[model samples]
Target: MAYYKTNKDGDGCCSHSDGKEHSNEHIYEVHGHDKNEHYGESCGGSGTCRCEDTHKEDGVRHNGANASSKCGCGTGHGRSACGCGCEENFGSLKQTAFQFGTAAVFFILGILFAFIFYDIKLFNFLNLKLSSVFFLASWTAAGYKVLFTSFKNILRGKIFDENFLMSIATIGAFCLGEWSEGAAVMLFYNLGELVQNSAVEKSRKSIIGLMDLRPEFARIYNPEDLNGEKLINPESVKIGTLICIKPGEKIPLDGIITEGSADLDTSSMTGESLPRAVKPGDEVLAGFVNLTGVIIVKTERDVQNTAAAKMLRLIENAQNRKAKVERFITAFAKVYTPIVTAAAVLISVIPPILNSLIFSAPLNGFESFSPWISRGLVFLVISCPCAFVISVPLGYFGGIGGAAKKGILIKGADYVDALSKAGAVVLDKTGTLTNGVLSVQKIIPSKGASDTGMITAEQKEVLTYVLVAEAHSGHPIANAIRKYASENLSGTEYEEFKKADIQNYSEIAGKGISGLYKGKPLFAGTESFVSDNLNGGISRSENSLSGTRVYAAFDGKYLGCIVLSDTVKTDSEDAVKELQALGVKRIEMLTGDNEVSAKEIAEKLKIRYSANLLPHEKVERFETISSEIKAENKNNTVIFAGDGINDAPVLARADAGIAMGGVGSDAAIEAADVVLMNDNPVLIAEAVKLSRFTRKIVWENIGLAFFIKIGFLGLGAFGIADMWGAVFADVGVALLAVFNSLRAAKCRKA
Candidate 1:
């Protein structure tokens, strides 16, 4: 048995840090105590060993197994400790159902008494009828919270909310002797609210199910006794600690494999279904599942800093930032309520006075005022803005959740709105459209040198000197050259370069690396870097090559050039085509790579290209393109996608920035508005499609709510409709709009 510390911030599986009360209980394990002495009947073998002992060092004390405990901070730990928040959600739903059931019974009984026992005189108080008593009971039960909230809000100077509108309308009905209609209105409104809550909870649970990637426990590797490996909380695991990952278990943290090999399933983190094979020394991230073989890993990051944790935090915080449409609705509700309230007052007072004055009829009877007053009450009920206030935000929330399920993280609803209107798309060439992995494609020796097959004696000698220089550098080209040498050189030749002495190693950014190999000056980089050190430059013939060329020089003589290329991603062409189909008018590529390689990729993808641009120049180019696109259509937006730190500036400058999260640098992810977790270019098009669909659903809900409320308001004011019709307009229409908003959560696959 082991003991683990409690999560003080309540961000663990059991407790939610959002300040909502949860019924799930978390048990704090007690160390250095006898289990039998502290065990209680209420423990029920649920793995929670509540202790009677007080631990002063840990600042925890337990009175009994069934009793509550307090932490060092003096906050009591109750039922929020074991599971997710589902239990509390279900409990709330049950309570709403019980209240609705009780109110429904009373309302039905009152109706029965009024219709069947009309002449019978039951118990009465202060001239109140028997039916009136049952109706009052029903209203009190269903509308108590609403009435209390309305009173509190009015005292706080917040009088333009839905609760106030409902309270005034239903209380007015009861004042006019319409007890049954008043009870019915409150009962139906409660029902609608219950349905709305259930829908929202359903969407929340759906997102949780999709993103439940956190590992509960990590096995600490014990080399001396393999069978004695300890299971500990992932958050407690420190960096550089050895951890054992068994087959079928998730890698608990980002680390490099120190031993063994396996195939990993990265779909949870990247949304790609293909299994990637890895050997010792390969880097693995948290949330990736080990498919086969046990591997020992040295942790590089702690639990809270893992990629999975960052994504979860991003999704949770996304809702706090509202879109323009959502802000408009909120502002509309504030002004809309006051204006509608004024109209209701005018309808109640002005119409009857005009009729009495014009027709010369008496204005002193209850009958004359009843008709116009009833219309005003109905108008208030019809004008409640609950449908717009609740459903509009819910619609945007559903969109964000649905996009996350597909491995696309939209930072907020504002980005979703921008993505839906995307007209110009600019993409970085390397690591975005291409694989970003440089590999040796061709190696050619200097002219007049004899060669055999792909590698001659002179080529091997040239590569040996090149490797000695590159071994000191960590650039991607250096790695590619090393890999090629290792696979092609003989065992003795490889050992020769490995043991070669090199000094005065230096690197120039964006050009090449230089070192003194065996006391001879050696250079391996771009044509200018190698030629600048020589009296005469190398031939420009290599510049016509399709891939990037790196020229090497040794002892003031040209040793030849190595052609390295980064292959374009398999999906890049299809992604561009899909963007066109989605109505994106301007599609282009911007790259710091040379003109030859950039043009080759752009031609293959069938889009426009701008080559030989620096990082800042890319941003300037994007701004010019954005201006042209916006000038044509003011609503159009430009989106720039990239994965490197250099691309961070342009990613931030665009109207909406998309980052390749899987392989993207931290700076790019932070500056981006949307992150494609899969690192797949095709997901860019999928995001656009999903955004348009979500926007369509949101507008549909707005249209549905407005049409019904306006039609019913007009009907109620003219005396053609009654309180019953107003109930249908407010509660019925709200429920319909809510159900429609739920459809936005059903995202289609790319």
Candidate 2:
């Protein structure tokens, strides 16, 4: 099979076969390369949207792909087929204001009629009847939707919602000839509904704000026709097409900068405060605003696979994957409503029976039991669990939205729960704790290992052999040696060395690569790989080497070693300290690097480390640690942080997986539960803080709803509270709980 590489910094190691680009980093096999290719088709279902397994960014399948529009009308944008979008929150504040305006008009008219005509006896032509008519108008104005929806739900066989409860209690008041009480109950309930709607809309707005990042169109330039440029929908653009971005325009797709340079405001994508500078060969994601200059970019992925599109899809579908708490509340409400209604029925009937049979009291026809029946109605109204059922999920949604605002993408609400209980975080050393860019630390020639001032002939000869073996590979170590040789060797010497004919190039996974350079054999890889090929002539000790050792063998002779080192990120130490302060019980490092190198980095960061492990062994170590933590505290979670294609197994195995999104492979991103948009280790602590804050808000809402409901249940039982009081206890408390739930969106940095 032939292997081809794509643009340098974009999708790495892509093989073009059968007219499709198979991204090697993501495990997409054009024919049979990828084994786990059962990733299902893209989700266009009601509440879920996921990229298919073995799917490539160049060939994205989205829900909106079938539709020719992006109007949220079942086109492939992953939205439901509703014309108003899936949410009913548009202009909610204005709708509430309109309802209040009409209710106020009717209430004032009814009050004037009662005070001037009925109470004063001014107009005696059925003044009480006329006053009742005005109050009825006020009640209709405030409670029309409640009455209509309750009956609609009843006809549909879906009863016992909050609207049904309010409707039955208020109508029961009117039937008992308490017209003013009935009107007042409906009025207060409607007011509470307005408050609840407004608060919910406010929380939802925090998420909807992300929609502003989607670009309207992309400017494409035609290279064949020099003067041809067209503006088209971003979704219509294909991969590998060149698009021009002018200053002040938002980037419409993920691509590589092919021409020009500029500063880009990437806060919407990564939440970084400063603008990033981009030159040719730099990768750029969608939703960033180009601050200055014109840059031509070659699109690397389709619109559906862009970062902005994925973020939007994840958020829109978050509510469908209910958290455990949310599912429990749903089940509880289903049982709670009927049980409370049955108890209310018993209270209305059992007292009458006991009074007639046991006490031998005088029994009037129907009026004797009217007061108890009215109290039972009040009990029914107070029993609605709207506050707990509605506010808990709303709080979690707010938390998810808030985390997205900070550039952390949590796939589902359940992961938010797992993050709250995380006790240990396992970090991969190469890209998670340190920048993965390898640099040449030292070069030792076998003949003149101590030469420092000038490059000798033997040193040039050794470098020439290593360069020929590494020229066709894209590994970081290979690039580092190529870079070192290009900078150290003179132009004439480099060109002369590069002219050597190489053939039969092949790579050995986890070891090194080999080829025939100038018709003689040459190889580069780990120390063991090179020492095996040298026939007992050379055995260099690698214990003294603190960094990665690249050994080279040329024509059955040991050519010596090149030491390459990767530097720790500047924020790694600070990130560790922050996680400790945030109550992470254990922090550990896992890496494939040598013991000396791994221990040096781990000691500096003050964390435990497991060194010299393969990819599968990392998962085994994590499982053992997780089992021990669970034995101590069943609620404790283990989170794994990694950034390579090899890290996907451990990433998916952990309780909560955190990936360095900025430089991570696509497989790692897909396997991770939480993705930190920027490669900053400190964001892990931030995600934990957000989840804990959200959980706090959820419990507060639950506690407040129960406290008020319990008090009102007692009052309704004892005949101390009327329908008007029940309305305040039910609807008013629900409104207050919703307002408290909005606090989840206001989480601050810890």
Clashes per model (N, Cα, C within 3 A):
5, 6
Per-prediction TM-score to the true structure, in the order listed: 0.86, 0.84
Model 2 lowest lDDT segment of ten: 34-43
The segments of candidate 1 whose C-alpha lies over 4 angstroms from its true place after superposition are 1-95, 111-131, 448-451, 472-474, 490-509, 514-523, 529-534, 554-558
| Candidate 1 global TM-score | 0.86
How displaced is residue 409 in candidate 1, in Å?
A: 1.5
Best by lDDT: 1
Q: Per-residue alpha-carbon lDDT of model 1 for 532-571, expressed as tens digits? A: 9988678675677788777899989988888889999999
Clashing pairs in 2: 39-53, 63-76, 64-75, 64-76, 64-77, 65-76
Scored by CA lDDT, what does every candidate get?
A: 0.79, 0.75
Given candidate 2, what's the lDDT at residue 27?
A: 15
Best by TM-score: 1
Q: Global CA lDDT of candidate 2, please?
A: 0.75
Backbone clashes (count) for model 1: 5
